[model samples]
Target: MVRRGVLGYVLVLVGGLVVSVLPASSAVASLPLVADLRSSTGGRMLGLAVVVVGLGLASSAWLRLVRAAGDLGVREDDRTALVHRATAAWTLPLLLAPPLFSRDGWSYAAQGVLTHLGLSPYVWTPSILDGQVVEAVDPMWLATATPYGPLPLVWGSAAAGLTTDPWLLVVAHRLLALVGLALLAWAVPRLSRWSRVDPARASALVLASPLVLAHGVGGVHNDLLMAGLAAVALVVAARHGWLVGALVVGLGVAVKLPAGVAGVGVVLVTLPAAARVSARATRATQVGAVSLLTVVCIGAVSHLGVGWVHALGVPGEVQTPLSVSTQLGRLAHLLTGADLVDAFRTAGSVLLVVVAVTVGLRSRSGDRRTALRATAAVALALVVLSPVVHHWYVLWCLPFLAAVELPARGWQALLHASWLGGLVAPLDSSLRGADAVIAVGVAVVAATALVQAVGHRRAEIRAEVRAGAQARTGDASPTSPISR
Candidate 1:
């Protein structure tokens, strides 16, 4: 455990260092202090190589420590929890350091400010800001607002009403993330208990995860808020044996449209039963009741009750490489000399829905918790594979992955590493003129290393499962315990 803690901290410390030095974003008020630093360096290139290398090394070390400690006995569980918490402590500062941490967040704030001014957000775009009172408009918005769900717009606009300072919005967004963090503190232990996973083990895994800490806590991504609601819904559905799982999912939708990814699973879980017949019936009933609740709630919050649908159409302009449509856009630019990232994203999202539905219905081959986890994994994979994968999308799977009885340790490691790397991905984009290099070298390279961690865990879990099965069958002598 001591070794694991030392190794993990060393790595995380390195990663944090890398994160800290990366260039600030466009939103930061350019202070002469940085110019002084640049002048000291003779305006030469900053320690780009060192920053990237440090984060890389730290990320790898942290990944290894998580795997090594996960393999320990009862003591390993306690150690894992401790190390995870320590790692999570890095979240706040890391987020505070980045310039691009709140690109979309600012858009939400803009909409909020606009709404407070008696203007319908559905009709407002970032382009309208030239004559409007506002914080620094996120140049990243190009000419439009978001393509995200409307609930966030409403809430963000409300928050925006509270301040005209871009810096203040950043602070507000972070504070909002604390609510999601509190929810995690409350739910993770319970979710772990439901899975029969050690509460401490579960807490360490979910509570301390780099993804949950960075994306959910630091970046103030709305995904966390909706994720908390979805988790709450999951727990409530199981506890009450209610057939309104759809409503829980709907609340998530109230936050963001992407949440419907998990909502679909909730519907399956809440199908109603005929005379307490099969689990399907009860789950179905839950779906119906939840769906009704979702519609009513959305209507109450939206401009025209259906205006969000229209606002969704407005975000069709921003071309982003983080999304899958990046590839298609490149192809279009090559062939027709046209930029189509947003259009491609829309089409890609459509196909993703199809794939998600197919997987949810087909993977219908596991236990209750298993089914839920599998559904979440599919959703996450789809999000990752989708064009323009904002880092926070990872928040969708962090909790579910932690709660599930996964088949291998490699899987767990993959989730962790990918999560950590994701938090750092946008840091590159914040760097002027160096984004391409940083994104590819540090961010992408780190992600690949994290994938290896996943492989290690997957291989490890398979061996453990097989050994247990053999022992249960009385087919082998129990001469030794497995070690990784």
Candidate 2:
């Protein structure tokens, strides 16, 4: 057991080191070393291969660590602590690594520079800036307005106050992301217990997840901060009262609009199990009022106003396969030979609203478990039906889902998806032409092997459960030594 833990830690650490050497999308072109590597076809190909391999190693290590935490011999508290320790140790290598899967970290820094210049990010694009900071932003987004909430801009502005160097700015963004990871570590166990799920398993599922490591930490996405705040809000609401939860979730919403879904959850969980429909309605109203007021206050203090709400459509400008709506639109266009992408996307938005409303209404019975599950469902719906989707968007629903008890197959699917999400980072990066093809091929092979391994593990788990049951039955027999 000790050996396996050590091996997993070492594997992930080494993987992080290998991946960190590759040039990031936002790497300064003037850097002699980076320019030399980028100019070489052979170097690019080799770097791509190394990144794929590194991601695989890290993902495999994460799987091993998660499984080890599930050892029946370990106490729940010990298991939770072990996962936490593993997460902290594994994060060390990537803590200062270049942005692994996405260039959003650089964009964040650029936005902060904009904020510091007294320009509203929602009103101005990074293109307005001059110097290294603007150069670090993705060209595609250079002229596009930011879709993120005002609170994130404020956070970025704070980081900008420290330095204007793009690299240091990215590192600062990463450090801020760590604050969110810490919040998740603190909240997941409590939420798991509330939902009657195993705290250790939940911790491993959310904290040690490759998705969290590769994107939440490595990519420096604001989704991590939003998720942590939402989780803490739910826990606080359940403990203190719905009012506090509203305040906390409002902060989350100020980070990202999708987090407002948790506000509904806070209201549901705070209601009495046998509360009347009228009571549910009244509770929802109060929570909604408090949450709205909090968000307004945050916007006012940030001085960015609410222009971000209008700019939420910014992400839809770029179409990616990750979006279910986009796929559906493509399928429709192919079938009818008509440009139905926009129409289909609009329908998806409407459908999302319907599904969220249905889930929220059904959880009015006030069962905390059901309320939590409902919140997860709403978050899932938001991602699936949105006009645009990013790999890290899964963070929105992950914490809530991790807290809920799932079937064996459900857990297996979620685990595999999380690992695969991290492993697919290369494809999401700036790799083009041959490098992209190689990434796709490697991802396919890795995904297949992962599925097979999980299937085998599932069989072993079933066998163990059967054996344990039989042993207990034998011990209960009249002629057995213990029975005698």
Candidate 3:
């Protein structure tokens, strides 16, 4: 128990809970303890204190849970799966409440609902008529008012059209996101099964992860639709079929261009595995079927034309700490007069390209052995290294990490904490003051993940060494590295 990471997780969570439970209303005495960002002279300090404590608690709880996952180990499949389940499960309550500072979720819902009404959402600002209730979309989104993409608009419209109330629209969108999650839970395992991976563990990692709960359910970002589609596409491709694979992957790209990272992995799988003409043809057949499926479904749903293309006109979000806007802010502060916002957008775009190339190179071997891992790294790296990274963006990486075979306790602990920090960045004023927290936290978790992956390589090498020695000596009494 002492060696396991659970003890740390439990302690931190309890400490955070204690802090959170404090009566923050008595700011006359507690003002001194308020975070710097919340250190405003006004009575807002009391509310700020509460938000800070809550964010801290959430961050601690998330990290501890990740550590718990590491403690469970690979061989303990059921137990390990349970850990991911525990983390994934919390998403239920958090999402039921208000949109937890996830402005993106709100905008997505707003756009979808508007589209469903046959209104040009991008052109019709949520700021129109009522207050800026749909605050997530571009200020110019309504002005640009062009149709973005067919799929997202259809989804957004349906979700939004469910109710006239902004709040209700958010709820319906989350429900739709939940449906996407069901597809993910079903699809990832099936993909693993067909690919001969650790089907139980792989499925567990994805289906039960804390990150998924936080973002998919908590943030309720529409990226889940993209990820779920991507996973199904992989399953199709890995089964040695390509047409359906292309269509699904294409749909993923339609939802979010970054979702296209999976296509790189698919391309890798297609090359050697389909090296033979017959295999290549079979793969082509699958791709064609998938293409047809996507085309027909999207066509039936909406008019796939200029209106849909216009939906993507709103390129970057500038309000939150997580986007290219953040970098732009810093650079503008440095460079005499150039806009940091412009800098950030440029930097983020370049980053996406780099991550794509890197993922492509790593996955070129065309084996499922590293396919998911490489794809995830590519996806995550794109977000992490970008000028702006959002909490929901983490959803893009969780599935790959879930399916990864190795788990390092220390690194997992870091990821757990960082995931929580992502949640905190929006609500806590302290985070704004101590903005450094997010940057440091993200670096820590990313480093942790890298360490865990590398550590596995070292462990494997040692195991091989021990096995070779045993073979030489023909010893039966010594222990095996993996048997425990």
Q: Model 1, 24-78: lDDT tens per residue?
A: 3433224454434333332212333333343444445444445434543446456
**Candidate 2 CA-lDDT value:** 0.75
What C-alpha RMSD separates each model from the true structure?
6.5, 4.6, 8.4
lDDT for 112 in candidate 3 is 64
**TM-score against native, each model:** 0.70, 0.88, 0.65
Pick the winner on TM-score between candidates 1 and 3.
1
Worst 10 residues of 1 by lDDT: 38-47
Top lDDT prediction, candidate number:
2
The number of clashing residue pairs in model 2 is 0
**Using TM-score as the measure, which candidate wins?**
2
Judged by TM-score relative to the true structure, which candidate is superior, 1 or 2? Answer: 2
Q: Write the per-residue lDDT of candidate 3 for residues 1-484, one digit (tens) a residue.
A: 2112233233323222222212234232244543432344332333433333433344444434433333323344664455445544444444444344344555666666656666665456555534434443434443445433456667666665556555566667777667768768767666554434455545544554444554565556677777788777776776754555687787876666566667656755666742554544454455445654664577455754334445553544434566654666676777767556665666676777777665555443457756666666777676666554666676676666555544456334434434554434334222344444445544544554455446544654566576668768986333431222
Q: After superposition, how far is residue 63 of candidate 2 from its true place, in Å?
A: 1.1
Task: In angstroms, give how far residue 304 of model 3 lies from its true place.
Answer: 6.1
lDDT to native, each model: 0.55, 0.75, 0.53
